[model samples]
Target: MGIVVVEICDSNFLLSLNIEEIIESKYPEVAVLFNDCLGFCGLCRLKPYAMVNGKRIHGKTPEECLEKIKEAIEAELAFYA
Candidate 1:
């Protein structure tokens, strides 16, 4: 019913994949924000990750992380439905 906030670190390797475009195009109600730092310690440097509705979702690879992010978003949307 409301916007789903997906926050990613600006320095995250996932950015190189144009994740913002991919996610926003797929989910109109989702907002993908690339912040300077997500304050997850140094985890951003080690893996692909995103904060979906304040929940941390990460994966070994960027592609995997993107899929998990979508799944997390879908799960959140289901509650509204």
Candidate 2:
């Protein structure tokens, strides 16, 4: 099994959601990195977003973003799994 890397900027955590916690709890072999900065300040501060497999994924709402992030992870995991 390979580890999936999820990069999240440490700018603003939208809607008080714990992204790292969610990812850790959902995926088995995964690395959730609360990176210092992913160089996306506007996106990070505005809405809920994450970088899965180096791809930016964002959502209108926190819940939606969480689900999308999970979906992105699953999609990436599919390739490696």
Candidate 3:
């Protein structure tokens, strides 16, 4: 995989997965940042999601969002392949 930019909400209560660790271990090339807020507090406060390559990937739960994010990452990396 190539460079994947991910930004996630810093609130632990809202997410069901340890996003940073999961992606770091599985996709070493991805650069993920956890911020206090991504200016999408309204959405971030409601669902589990990540901004992958600037695209918003969302899911009702963390596991689902993580999978979606991974798919998005693969798709973006494919462009470089």
Identify the leading candidate in terms of TM-score.
Answer: 1
The residue ranges of model 2 lying beyond 4 angstroms of the native Cα positions read none
Q: Which 10-residue window in model 2 sums to the lowest lDDT?
A: 12-21
Mind giving the per-residue lDDT tens digits that candidate 1 earns over 1-81? 237999999878788688988998999899988799989989999998999999999999999999999999999888888
List the candidates ranked by TM-score, beginning with the highest.
1, 3, 2
What's the distance in Å from true for residue 43, model 1?
0.5
Alpha carbon lDDT of each predicted model: 0.90, 0.78, 0.79
Tens digits of lDDT, candidate 2, 6-67: 88877756437877777788787778887778898687888878888788888888889888
* Model 3: ten consecutive residues of lowest lDDT: 11-20
Q: Could you give me the TM-score of model 1 versus the true structure?
A: 0.94
TM-score of each: 0.94, 0.85, 0.86
Q: Report the Cα RMSD per candidate.
A: 1.5, 2.0, 2.2
The global Cα lDDT (0 to 1) of model 3 is: 0.79
lDDT of 1 at 44: 93
Candidate 1 ranges with C-alpha deviation above 4 Å: none
